[model samples]
Structure formats: C-alpha cells, structure tokens
Target: MTSSAPRRTVLAAALAAAAGAATPSAQAADAARTSEASAPAATPQAAARRSKSLVDYHSWTTTTDWHKGRAQGTGITHGARPGIHIVHPVGTLDYKDPHTGRTTTWDYAVWTSPAHSLKVPATEVIASWNAHTPPATWIAVELRGTYSDGGHTPWYVMGRWTAGDGASDIRRTSVDDQKDGRSSVSTDTFAIDAPAGGLRLTSYQLRLTLHRKPGTPLTPTVWRVGAMGSDLPDRFEVPASRPGQVGRELVVPRYSQEIHKGQYPEYDNGGEAWCSPTSSQMIIEYWGRKPTQQQLSWVNPDYADPQVCHAARHTFDYQYEGCGNWPFNAAYAATYRDLQGIVTRLTSLTDLEHLIHAGLPVITSQSFLKTELDGAGYGTAGHLMTVIGFTKNGDIVANDPASPDNAAVRRIYKRRQFENIWLRTKRYDAKGQVKSGSGGVCYLYFPAKPAPTQHRVLAELGIH
Candidate 1:
C-alpha cells in the first residue's frame, strides 16, 4: 500500500531520469526488466516506486571489507581482512607445567582500524561483527581517542564478549536503565563522556580481538568488523512528520509485544519491553528466516511466541543485563543464514523511503512525548520501531511493536511528527540551516550475496 505526495512526485521524476541516464549491471538490469514486464504500471510515479536498479545500487554497499585494517595475534591466517581467518595453534603450543599443574594458553587475533584524526569529535563508537555459530564466543573491543593537544584517553575496554560465564568477561550493557538513562548492566558500545565543549579527538583507533580456549580444536570464523561514530547532543526536539511522499508498504509480518507480556518477567515481561527483539524478529522473518527449533527450545512450551524469547536470550548482554543493546541487535540479526546487518545513522525520511522502495524495511530509534508523536498514543524516553513503508501522502507506515496485539501492529504516523521523533534532532539552527546530525540512528540488514562496496553509501539524502 502507498500514498502519493508532492515530494514523492519529484523523487519519481528524479529516479526516472537517473534510470534513463545510468547503465545498470547485468543482474540489476535483469531484475528491472523482469519487473517492468510482469508488474502493472501506469504513471511514472508507480514505475519509479517499482524500480529494481535503485535498490541494487544501494544494496551494493550494504557490507564493507575491513581487510585494509591491521591484524595481529597468534594462530591467525588472513581471510579477506583481519579477525576473519583460520586459527590453528600448531607451533610452540601452550604447555602445562607438570610440577604445579598450571598451563598457559594464548590464542587470539586482533584487527585494528586505520588511525585517523577527525574534524568533529565523536562521542560514541559502535562496533559490529559476525562469527561462525556461537556468535560472541571469545571477542573483545578496545578503543582510544587522541586529543588535538596529543593527550589521549587510555585504551578503554568497550566490551569483552565471552560465551560462557566467567569473572574476566566484561561486555557492555545490552539494555539501558529506563529510569536514569544509564546502561542497564552490560557494556557493548563505547561512549566518550567529554565535557560540554565536546571532545576534540585528532585521532581514533578501534581494535577487535578474537580469542579461543587453549587446547580446543574449535575455531570461530569472524566474518567482518565495522564501526560508526555518534555525538549525543544535549538538546533534541522531536518533530512531527507532515504530508507528501509515497513509497511501497511492504507486508512485513507483524508481531505484537502485548502477547508476550508477563511471559518472561526477568526480560521486562516479554513484549512489554522487548520492542528491540520483537522488531528484530519481524525483520529476520521478513527475510525468510526464523529462530531454529533448537534456538527456542529453551523457552517454556506454554509460551506462544518463543522466537521473541529466543531473540532476548541471544541478544542479552551479560554485562549490560539487558536485551536492547543497539549493536547487539544488529549482530544478532547477522547470526541468521544469509542476512547481514549494520548499525549506521540515517539522515532523513527521504533516505528511509529509498530503502523501503528498494524492498528493505528499516528499524529505527526514537524518543518522544505521547503528543509529540501523534497516533502512537504513548510516550517513551526511547523506543525502537520498524519502518516498513510510507503512506500515499508520505506519512510513515510502520510495524510499531508498541501495539498490544499483532492485529494492531501496523500504524501510519504523520511525516514530520514521526521524522522529528525518529531523527531526534533540532529542526533548524539559529542561522536557519538544518541541524544535519544523524541522531537518526538505524539498523540496516542486507543479504550476504552481492556484497556491499568498500565505501558504503549509507545515506540517500546525504544528511549524515
């Protein structure tokens, strides 16, 4: 379903012109030719919305290669990039002292991004990755930022992800404290708490480590590693999304949080607080995958929605003690068969529309008063929702997990109201220029096939 608007009409024209001027790749051309032959089309508006080349173009940069990053560690073999390779500790193996019966086992790998100074200091760093099977078996991330004066923040342990229970494990919070806005208990992401003036970091470096047990033959293959920067400002005014845009409203399966409420009290009573997992589940299923039977077997059989429980368990940050960690959710999605996920900041509703038109639904974060986001009927300091598509007039059509039941999951919000809450930025500065900050954080999932380019074109409107 779609609604028409003035802005969409203009976008329709622009896309048409682009389609004509460009020479698409063979795969993209075939998809476009096939769609045009089979699908009913009349107006330029409808044809623009149904184009495949547009989607393929953006899809090309969904995942990035980190091979250029430096790699260091024992039992490491290269595979495209750092942290992604075969690990076999064969030479000078860790040995046990017969006298004390103590052994020293060291097998690990590290991938560090190229050190680069920045003009605008970043307040937060988000690292995401995928490993074979048991996702975070033995992994940790450390980051450091150097100030213009040459002073540097000592390397901080963003998080140490080890699968089993151990005293040495130090992972970031997976959930946040709803009351005080602090991390719930785990630490997966790193944030530099600079003074009001902001930290002027001249250089930044991120390192990811993959470790293994001393004598085990088991080796985990790390797929890739990537990071993003965020600056959390003090003042953010939520806006209302007004009319005039049209895009496809995908039939993304709906799941209501209400059904799972009280099913698992420890996890904020299931649906009532599992918006992140629920949204994640919906998108994962939309991609034609679901939690395996073994994955959900841990849950009580009486629970109707076991997948939501499965998501919560895997996404739980032991250190954070919560399931809503932003990067963790994206990483969890990547655990599935073909789908790969990335955490990035989107700039505008226009960028979102492109993904939707490309047949991809986006998961987004927002904070707002009930009145600020009309039709939601509820307010939150923060929340996550799935942006499925747009209404004819350009309003947002979403699968809001906030609904009490699956039947009530789909919602259409006013464009400006939804955009304001979704992006969480100032409408304009004193000088009347758009604030242009990407408090508009989102999670993008794409297939492993047709791998994304080295430099991802994440934003359609170039706001970020």
Candidate 2:
C-alpha cells in the first residue's frame, strides 16, 4: 500500500538502492552475529546514543510547545491536553477536491513551528499529527526543510487528513508528483533524491493549516504534530540483539486481511492490500477502542469482521491509492475517544520489548522474501503486522494479517531474521536485487490518558 505498484512486484524500483549492495545470505547472518558478540554491552546511555544518531523524533504537544510556534489565526487551548484551534479567520481559499470533484470554499488558519534541528541529519522524514476534525473541518500538514548544504526544500504537503468520511469531508490523501531536483516526497515520506551523495535534511519546520466550512464555529483541535527523521546506515544486515522479554506476550486481537478480500475494492482494491489498516485495527481494539455498531452500520451484513472492512475504508489514501499511509493510520486510531497515536521508528526489538512489557502491542512494517522469514508462508514487497509479544525462546509472536483466517493470524518468526528485515535499510528481493527495508517503522496507539508506567515508558522513548 505504500506504492502504486502491486505488492508482489519487486520494490527495488520504488525504493532505489545504492550501488554494489550485497545480497542477504548465511555469511551475512554469521557476520552480524560475530559483530554483535564482539561489541560492548549496550548500556542505556550507549543505546540512546546509537539510536539518536540513526533516528531523531521531535514533536509539539504541550501548551508551551504550542505557544512557541507562530500562529497567524490560531489560539492555544490549555488544559489537561493542550492543543491549537482556529481563533480568527486569516484567509479563505477555494479547493476542488480531486476525489469528490467539487469546489468548496473554506476558512483557513495557519500555525508554523519554529525551525527544529534534527539530532541526526536525516535522509528521510515522515510527519504525523493527532487532531479532532469535526464534520466540516480538516487539516493539512506541510513541511519545509533546510539541507546540509544550506539550500532549502520547498514546502511539501505531507498529508491532507480528517477523522470523518461523511459527505462534507474531503477525501484524506497524500500528495503526488511533489519533488524538486534534490528531494522528493513519496506518499507520506520526504526523501532526499540521492542520500549516497551526502545530501541530508539538517533542520525543518512544520506548517499546520486548519480548514473548515466558511462562516462556521466548527474547528479542528490539534494535540500533536511531529516528524521522525532517520539516516539509517546502508546495510543489508544488522546486528542481532538478545531478547529481554521472553515468555511475555500481550493478548492482542487477531484479524486477517485475506478474510476481508474483495470486500471493498474502491479502497486499495479490496482487503488484499489492507495490511496496514488491518494491523492497525487489531492494535486499536487491543487498546479497548472500537467502532460502535451504529458507526459500522454502513458495512454489509454478510461480511465477517465488518470492523475490518470499516478500517479499510477509513484509512484509505486517495492520492497514494493505498491504505498504508503511516500518519493516516495513526490519525484514524486517534479518532476514537481518549486515544492517541503516532508513527515512529524503534531502534531495535529491545524497544518493542519495552512496549510489550507495558501491555502495548506494536504494529510494525517490513518486506521480505518467502524464504527470509520462517513460517511466514509468503513474501511481500511491503506489509504490516502486529507484534504481540516474544516467545519463550525469544522469537516474535505476531498477528500477521496476511493469513487465511483470524485463527491463523498468530505466527512465530525467528528473532534474528525478523529484526534484520525490520531494521535494515537495504534488503535483497526475490530477483536477487537490492531493495529498501522499513528501518524499524512502527505505529504506537494508546490511551490519551495512559497508565503511570505506560506514560513513563512512552516518555522515555520520546513520545510525549
């Protein structure tokens, strides 16, 4: 769902690889093991240092965070959860929604964050936000970055999003064909045109434009706006880590994408391509938030797990033509009352273990060949699954949606193999060519009011 190409096709064309990238083999695995054994023990400080160099995450979440940003026509709402809302009309614009093909006038206001320097000069950046958009309101998130060479990137639209799919709501989408000679946006991610040539985004600022029907009191309240910047090293394999949370597993719900196949073709050609939303739905429900029966009344009665169908429709990205827009799925989970979500990258399975031990199941993204992951039974260019827990032997316990039924969704995968596929930047495809890996991409959905331990852990991981 991340690309326009079919899921089974080789992803190397979309995610270009560096020259002379090595193929994955037994020798690569052995080398990774030797490197891990020869390395010093990873203390908390050492892990943080390593993670900071690979990925940097920044967000504006507090009242103080909102006040620091320059607001044209927006005001800060301070309370238990501080946010920004439209206060006065700054301007108006006419937007012809491509999906709806209707021109509508909307009152708009803008809030621009102060420039933030990334800890890691990044080769890629993906922005995410949490907001409550009423029936007639939606938000557009854009980012402008300064390159390492002192040049600037034009403002690129990260996403046009809303929580509703009502008649008046604009179809949530990611913009296409947005690129300069030095950089370009692929769906929700902003990528340097050629990172191997030493190009990196050093600093960036985000612009949040809140839109609503003209002359109405309705306004969208934005609680969080952030981006994950990463410069993961180009490697086909990464050092394996020993599991710390063996024999512990969170009981996450199981849902299969295959069961919902051909259910809603308009949303990414049916459930065959709904790995993101399907995996998202499992975690959303695991957190005890689900669509009410009334909310799901639109679904067909004949379909099993109507909520799965509901998720596919809600998370569809019209421009990308897929349901896998990272921020879109996060925003959709936030729509539920007292829930919040964000898209971020975890450094390793140790990070996943921390969340799982706190009773939080993580949704992860990765791509691999049929032979790469044991017991997977299939390969994918890109797919998402819920990592529920670790096995007694330190393997991964995942509720993979690419199964024949809900009961078959739970599978055990080798820890080393899964970690490499998830964390590596480069990987080999079925054709023995280099392709991109997800570099530990994941979605964290939890209660807006988290438990004390949950809050502490999330804060430690820089989520607040």
Best by TM-score: 2
What is candidate 1's TM-score against the reference? 0.71
On residues 223-315, what C-alpha lDDT tens digit does candidate 1 reach at each position? 655566544443355444344336567768788766887776665445577788888888888777787797677799998778987777666
lDDT of candidates 1 onward, in order: 0.56, 0.83
TM-score of each: 0.71, 0.91
**By TM-score, how accurate is candidate 2?**
0.91
lDDT of 2 by residue, 1-464 (tens): 22232431222333463443211123323323333343233358845655555778889999999999999999998887789999997999899999999899999999999999998898889899999999989999999999999999999999999888789999898887788888888788888877777888999999999999987999999999999998877778889899775676666778989987888899988888899999988877776678999989999999999988888888888887888888999999888776788998988888787677666678999988889999998888788999988898889999999999999999999999999989987788788877788889899987776655555567767777
Q: What's the C-alpha lDDT at position 332 in model 1? A: 79
Give the lDDT of residue 121 in candidate 2.
95
Best by lDDT: 2
Superposed by TM-score, candidate 2 places the C-alpha of residue 187 at a distance from the truth, in angstroms, of 0.2
The global Cα lDDT (0 to 1) of model 1 is 0.56
Error of 2 at 222 (Å): 0.7
